[model samples]
Target: MRGHRPALRTPRVRTRGAAIAAFVALAPLIPSAAAAVGAQEITVKLPYDCALPPGPQRVAVRVAATFPDRVAAGEAIRPTGVTTTVELPAGAVSDLTALKATTVVPETGLALDVAQRGAKAQALWRGTGPARPVAVPAEGSLTLRTTGDAPAVTAVVNGDLTLTATDLGVDLALGTADGAPATPASLSLTCTLAKDADGHGLLATVPVGPSATPAPSGSPSPSDSAAPGSGRPTAPASPTAPGTPKGPTTPATPTERAKGRTGHAPKVGDARAGSSADRPPAPPCVKKNPTDKSLNAYITGYANVRKLSGASLIPVSCVQIEQGDPEIAFPPDGSIHLLQKSDAYLDYQGRKQTPPFKSTFLTFGFAPTTATMVLEQAGPMTVASDVLLVFPDNIAETYVRAPLVLRVLDVEVNGTRLDVGPSCRTQTPLSSPEPDPATYPGPHLVMLGKGQLINGTDATGYVLTSGGPLTGEVTIPAFTGCGAGGEDLDRLLTASISGPGNYVKQIQGQTCAVGVEVPTEGQCTEDRQPYVVPKPER
Candidate 1:
């Protein structure tokens, strides 16, 4: 956001040589005599009716003087200068443009010069030559025009203006430019606003209130009521009155003049008020997976194995698996569960572990017991789950056990299953002498037989490891999904699964294949049945 600071311009004053000198020499004597000439306060009305946009808008302002009155000294009163201070509501104004002042009082030899600071302007006047004295025109007016960016200019009555956000204060001082006060018997300052080319007169033609009644032509002037010791008259309790205490006193300092004065500005019906309570509560946040009925979803992988006994392990063929019935649930407490049914076959060399050989059930669940889930909003969801290789009771010889168990950890699931922990390594082949169970977790099945696989968590197996279930933790990448009833729900989904206890191949000593190895990498797609859960109520 850029700020617009008022540009400083040097004051332009035009004065004839002898007249300025004479006026300065008599400046001291003029104040006392001017005080007795009667105080003349005029109502300045500024009618504003402009159609503005909701935000900041620019409008042109025009201030003009009209109808000067005759003074008691048998000479017509001439206003050489007019100084006005306008304060806009806080935060309601931005910048001003095209600010200028000009005189309309015909050839009593008056010229105009303008100076302005933030919200304040002074129009100075001087005689054209030493021979001409400043004189006010009975019919002409002095006009000041400037463009300002304000919220809305409601109205300016007396010296107070109203805006939609706050009030604006305006102060007017008229007399000689050199600080000499010349009292006028009667005068009228007409302030008009030109909005969108339509002129709206702000000055009130009719008498305002009791305090603002018109003074008769021959009536004693308002300045006649001066206090005993002070040479200035008491200002009336009207909006047009200056904000300072009334009495003869020094001119206000620059700091004092810049301060905003408080006054009442009438409110208009253009602004509407609203409260936040009126808004309806928002729907819960949730996401759902897409459904694909085809059971062709498969994950495939290939890995190179090395036997620690100095033999190069077999180069495994690519393995493909079928996946089905995928469902993810997110509860209010921020826990998530992912369940899917999958099946794959194990083949090494000439022997094949056919269907019903090992039942495979992939269950990924995430429950954060200590730290918070990073996938709560829209990031990758990482959770802990175990990779379980279960061999069901089947036609294969009673049951075969290997010498070591395999554990997969640090599984990351984004859009795809990324790294699957460190590769399983082995020192002895399946044919080698079995290591003690205490020394090594007797080999857990790293591959599952085809027909033994079930669709979901119903697959049966035995515990083969000591620490816990094969399920560790796995992360699922963030995905877009539909909420309950097809509402748009976006969230990072994650889960942790307690590993299915390792599958015990045999109780006594049945023999399966020795030195068998499985690939460590694969990709698959699943015809997953998607399910959606409604967001829980607060």
Candidate 2:
């Protein structure tokens, strides 16, 4: 049903004798695997009857826009690269000439209907005049080519974004041959679709699918982030999948929706507040505008502190200053060594929640007490990847180090809140690699990741653009700087959470496209969004 549709939908046009003719006419427009590559281009031309100052004149309105055939639900529907052309009758020039004008400037507005999930809204697509004012031609009709950014839409449910072009309005300003404003007050004209008795003025339809979320561990989605891990360019946008589509859509998680950050596109280089997204070691300076092939990264990892027997979910985002060259390898062995040029970003040290735990310290005797903690990013996370050749052995390994410090908010002795003080924190930052017992105050947090094929992404490694699971072990250093009024609870804090051999795991979603590029959609509908972080590790 997602492919070619049954002919019954258009019985009136497809008679038995005309079957071959129809096939011939539609052969070039068939949707194929190739068409599913990126954003597709569409043009709609229609005739309109305008209410001109000199009376009604029939004209043509042609609209060109770029759109993806399919989009995940709750994702931004950016109808980019749009331009509109309106043909004007000679009478338009005559009216302007009557005002002693030699040239005319115009602005246009196109009103169309957008329907999704049984709801319809009229959208006014604006248009601006060409760079130069139109020179008044002494003869027949003059044409005005204009462009504008269509107001974007966000689809929350599965369905088709059906657009129907209907009414249009144009405002004109006249100028004399001397270049002075002849009619600065401006003259306006309106028009309506002449032959849209049915749905002939329908522009285009984009199907919206569901949110993309990976299954835990062994259970993976059909395609997590169909991104090519090797950083290959995504294919060109293809035609809409042909069929009597039954409201294209996928479901969104309720919990994600509750957070208010799920189901929308995050801005390029957008990092979560207080997560080192805007720290010193920033990733490669982002260009004013990134090219189509460029990509960014975001990840969430589960960390289990062995000393505390508690876990925390860490959210991180990154950008690539330089793409890892596939043709070249670091240490030219049979396997390719991909030196990825990307860096992890977390901004200000965001205070995050951690599980509550009970600890037994010698000083506290046999008393059972629980400490509630908040974990914060110490600094920017530095990340890179290890890639193997796609030919013989297929493996994309990821590596990154996170600097972090934990602070205890409150401690309850048998349900009694203990004044651990605001400054109760570890003396040194947590380290992810194997720690040296002799070195008591060193800080670090690192993760080792394994790549998963983002189906249809054509990529084979855990490049910045691709995503997968990363795991690691860490050592929580000893506690220091505790207590208020010199109550010094350093020993209590260290006994409760400071130690080593902690475990961590995380899944990074595929990078989303920014600039003039198509989105890198894997199986995740909303999985690629850095804004919608997953639930914490329980």
TM-score against native, each model: 0.14, 0.39
lDDT of 2 by residue, 231-289 (tens): 12222112222332322122222222212221113233333122111111111223334
Best by TM-score: 2
Backbone clashes per model, in order?
48, 28
Per-residue lDDT tens digits of candidate 1, residues 1-538?
A: 0112111110111011101111110111112122114333332333332222233323233233321222221122233222222222222221111111111111111112111011111111211111222233333322332221111011111211101111121111123434333232111111123342221222111111123346687653332222221213233223223432222112222122112211001112232221111111111111122122211111111111111000011111111122334455565776444434433222222222211110001112111011111101111111111222232322110112222212222222311232332331122222222233453343233332211222232222311100001111111222232123443222222122212221121110001111112100010101111111011100
Candidate 1 regions off by >4 Å? 1-39, 47-69, 72-83, 89-538
Global Cα lDDT for candidate 1: 0.20
Determine which window of 10 residues in candidate 2 has minimal summed lDDT.
17-26
Model 2: per-residue Cα lDDT at residue 254: 25
